[model samples]
Target: MTGAPSPGLGCVGAPRLLAGLDRMPRLDRTAHLGVHGQLPQLGPDELIALAEDIELRGRGGAGFPFARKLRAVSRSARARDGSTAVVVNGSEGEPSCLKDTALLLHAPHLVLDGALLSAAALGAEDVVVAVTRTDVEQSVREAVAERGPAGRRVRVVRLPERFVTGEGTALVSGLNGGAALPSGQKVRTSERGLNGVPTLLSNTETFAQLAVAARLGAAQYRTAGLASEPGTVLLTVAGSTVVETPTGTSLAYVLDLCGTEPGQGVLVGGFHGRWLDPASARASEVSRKSLAAFDAVLGAGAVLPLPQDTCPAGEVARVTRWMAKESAGQCGPCVRGLPALADVLEDAVRGGGAAALDAVRTRMAVVRGRGACSHPDGTSSFVASALAAFPEEFRDHALGSGCGRRVLGALPLPEDENPERLVVDWTLCKGHGLCVDILPDVVRLDADGYPAEASMPVPGRLRPKALRAVRRCPALALRIRE
Candidate 1:
């Protein structure tokens, strides 16, 4: 079967955003006369009960229980202080995922309500919504304006679109007026978030669910979904061929969606996520625990179906290369390790010897859990999962020749319009050739004597050397693409 049609509000075809619109309970006009009726204020105990009843897990890829996170913040007496804060992370940096943007755009009230309710429950006086500088910001801004007074108290902050900039810590840094990057030190936002206060930060959809939970008591919220994981989830579906089967397509498309048959494969949870064969995933349910049963979860709600006619191995190689580049370059292991893993994956795709596959396995083991952040771990997961899920494709490429098809960019990038590319301005070239000496894999000296071969795969291991080369180049001809 083919993939389902693209829904509205970032969902492929169905109106996922409008699912609970009419179902939302009417607000008490007397209590909220001056306040926007969009938000339904939830009590603390009710919120906890609702979360436990629905078993709502964090939508920020980690799949941690919402109740657990709440307890963590609530356990601390410091949470009672007005210094505590609630942050709505609308910065959907994962290129393959558009569910957050959908929530913010078409269902801003739901997201805002969740944030406001979370603040009230956590005893936080301030709530901030952090969004990318792109289209998401405009939608949230309009939502804030429509709410009038209630929205005024909720601050909306715009952020750069860097891939890592959307990480929880990075978002906190941005709100604190620092550069949009992860900190070198180990710090939890709950301990010190905006203005050095306890913060409850979560994905936009998580907050939307929170709002829903607050409105419907825990018992009612638990009515839907499995006992381990109650409630619906938002997913951005993509693939070479759209699968019409929809086991996890949300309420809007659940009736129309059908699940893919056996033998098919899909990329779940975006770039940092994993790949699974439909055959192996036949029994896989859409819940967090169900996916985890298969060593996978509905990460950040992204599901991409791969086409049978397309080269899965080639696709993996292409994405692996991009993943290597997305690293923040803060940690040495991530900066250097991901590129090495990507190269090995690429070699395997290009019909390289068994050594390539062996090298990938070895390097993957070394890179996993070594980064200051989760970048290296995520990259390793994507690679390792692809290898496990698509053994046939890997074997084919290894035994035979190339996959034959050109690398089609099925996966999205931080800047799909303009992918990162190396550039060298020859006008400034004094032929110092320090770049050539430093990054032989990326740059080489040509017949003209000046360094040429500007375009090359940037290996993670060579990033420091490459950066050194760029810095040492007196002429400043070499520049890394953003």
Candidate 2:
């Protein structure tokens, strides 16, 4: 049987994944081939009107209304220069998220149309698409290279693939050639981004949706999804179990939208997202506030179903460990607290003592809002949600038995891009043996009283101790597998 028809007029297939997308009218291919007629450009008021008509919310995780973001940037636009910059944030740093890359690869022009239209609407002078050093960047770069005069002012910026690097502020910081980390100083990218210029920055999918809305108008755009949401949403569906469903599934998978069949559970938004029973999900709408009411949001466009065979607690623990490692190590809370939380989670999964669960909760509370960015907050949300959603799993594990299966690492983790283990600067080492003392399971001292055996699993039981070791190390010679 043929797959479901694509959603919306411009593109179709799975809202997020672009499998079988080759037959569709790809915006990227059209622009790259110098097909200017197909590219739609809207003036500021027209673009604003289009945005208002569709009632398009930001497609990024936050789900801020597009019109609000536009207004914020427009208000910041200087009267003297009448100039603003549009930033297309394609940095898909969330390990489990692939929606941004899918759009960049399959429909580059859609995003460009949105950005260019928004820029014109705001009287902005420049458009910059920020992507990570991945295949997505190469595709976007080629698309940019192919644009004739229309793409002249548009540029593609390649960024590091760190977790925090994709945050709006971090992306702006990286574009300025600074370290790719969010600043503690409260500042809006719209008020100041890419060299202190007034800017309009949004996720790539947001721009593509804007482009579609501009062409189709609000009434046409509202035909597909719920009245409250008013448009189809792209969702990256990843799970162990696969289900065969009809094509053209409506965008609003609201609680009322989903049929009677019980869903296992869903990770709405991305890693920094929350969990809800698939059954409970049926009652939830796809609107920003609706999802928020359920303690969830339509984040960076990822909605993953958890298979029954896989243990949710085990999965949460694995992702927590990965999140711990992804810390940029700039702040004490993230640098120290995440590993501690991860350790507790790993212990809980291993069926450790009640102390382990208590430790995890304590560390999560300590780490929340303590990072230079939202990394800790996101990590804490994932863990806390899992604990709340799967009380039975936590109770079973607290008995100090086991979850019975090995962690499958269903949630993606950034692999060690640097293949080597921790390199100790021996000269910096004063033989304090704090590393060994804190993480005795992983780090042990040699007969000479020097640190050795650094390649063992850091135990969850010793997280607090390990953090003390990390803090007390005078030489700072000890490092995790980078």
Candidate 3:
């Protein structure tokens, strides 16, 4: 289950998570123990205190405070007679992300230590590490096997590698034996998750970072990076290479080291992240606050400096279209508004005049904060930033002129996945009608309200709807064929 850790190439100044990785690329049990030493033994209060002292924040896109989350779950568990669980989110589904993959593949034990250690502190019975890649799962599973009884408490699970499937609720649903789609409902994982128990779910990097902080303690850990946000962060540069640089490192240095030139602009964060002009990119640092000041987020730490040769307008249209398709299809804003926004942006690229530009703005407004999840708002921010980031290129498109450069697919996208079928487990099925309601065109209820067929061939376009139906079936009978 162990594999060679993915070594980052460019600027990995003052590596923390990847400490000793260059010499010891493959961190097996012995190497992990030798390098990082044993995980600190801390009680619930001490763990929360250490997290607060270090100012630990989730490295996931949202950047929620780690202490706040721990406190919430701890309080919820105490209120519920002291029962809880922990989930380590290793589902790095973004094509523009590899930091989590790097951490999980190379330093699996660090991530495990964080999750398991936290579980012990919170008195949680279960520790689940949800991953998307096979290599990562295998690596972590091997790491778990090394711990014997402790490993028994850890479960390595794989979810559908969809973009939105990384959402905490989506991972919870998948682990609960439902489809990996975010429910339109707003249920907090801290209160009820994973078998309807109070659970602490955080990103892969967050846990790994937590492990690093626990080992270093408060004062020593604060030695690196900014005083406020002390520590190193893993940046998935341009999607191909991963860099574990300190928090205060210059964004330009990382880009330059990765052989990227901020030509038109750099896309900070990932698809759901915002764009920054070249000037802003030069001014910003790796810290979250630095990027925020420039109206961008260090979300998922994905930084892509645009190449000068590609048409900025065309590239925006393509990425916007992809983001739209990646939607969960659970809300009206995403189901319609996002696709419409993409269409208008494409129209603007094709010399569709100012009216087309106005149409794009209109759709952005329509979708903003209107979805069950943050997809609509995030997608809207991405498009809006594109408009402001590259004014000249967009102005050319708006005035019925076009940027002469062709779209070189400067932004990377994931390859197509193998086609899958939907099947109902006969044991779980009870002639449920929920699937029928969601997929009226494809599925029909029998007189007894069971599916007409045991299995159905789901088309690519309607797969999201089918997945949604599979999750909503109270009987848990509907399942996507593996």
Clashes of each: 22, 11, 1
lDDT per residue as tens, model 3, 72-128: 999998888788999998887787878888888888889988998899899998899
Candidate 2 lDDT over 217-247, as tens digits, reads 6786677655666666665555211111112
* Model 2: residue 236 alpha-carbon error in angstroms: 0.7
lDDT computed for candidate 3:
0.83
Winner on lDDT between 2 and 3 is 3
- Highest lDDT against the true fold, candidate: 3
Worst 10-residue lDDT window for candidate 3 reads 1-10
CA shift of 144, model 1, Å: 0.8
Per-prediction TM-score: 0.76, 0.77, 0.84
lDDT string, candidate 1, 1-482, tens digits: 01112234322332222344333422122222222344556677767767777777788788778887776666653544646788988887766776676666556777878888888888888889998755667767777777778778788888877678778788898999988788867887777788887788888888877776676567766555565565566766553222222234332242125343333476767788777676545556666656766677677777776766667777777777777877888887778898888877766765667777888899899998778888888889888888888787788787666555433445544334443445678788888877777666667788877766656555433444455577778988877765
Query: Considering summed lDDT, which 10 consecutive residues are worst modelled in model 2?
Result: 1-10
Number of the top TM-score candidate: 3
- Whole-model lDDT per candidate: 0.68, 0.68, 0.83
Model 1: CA > 4 A from native: 1-17, 20-39, 77-82, 184-186, 239-263, 414-482
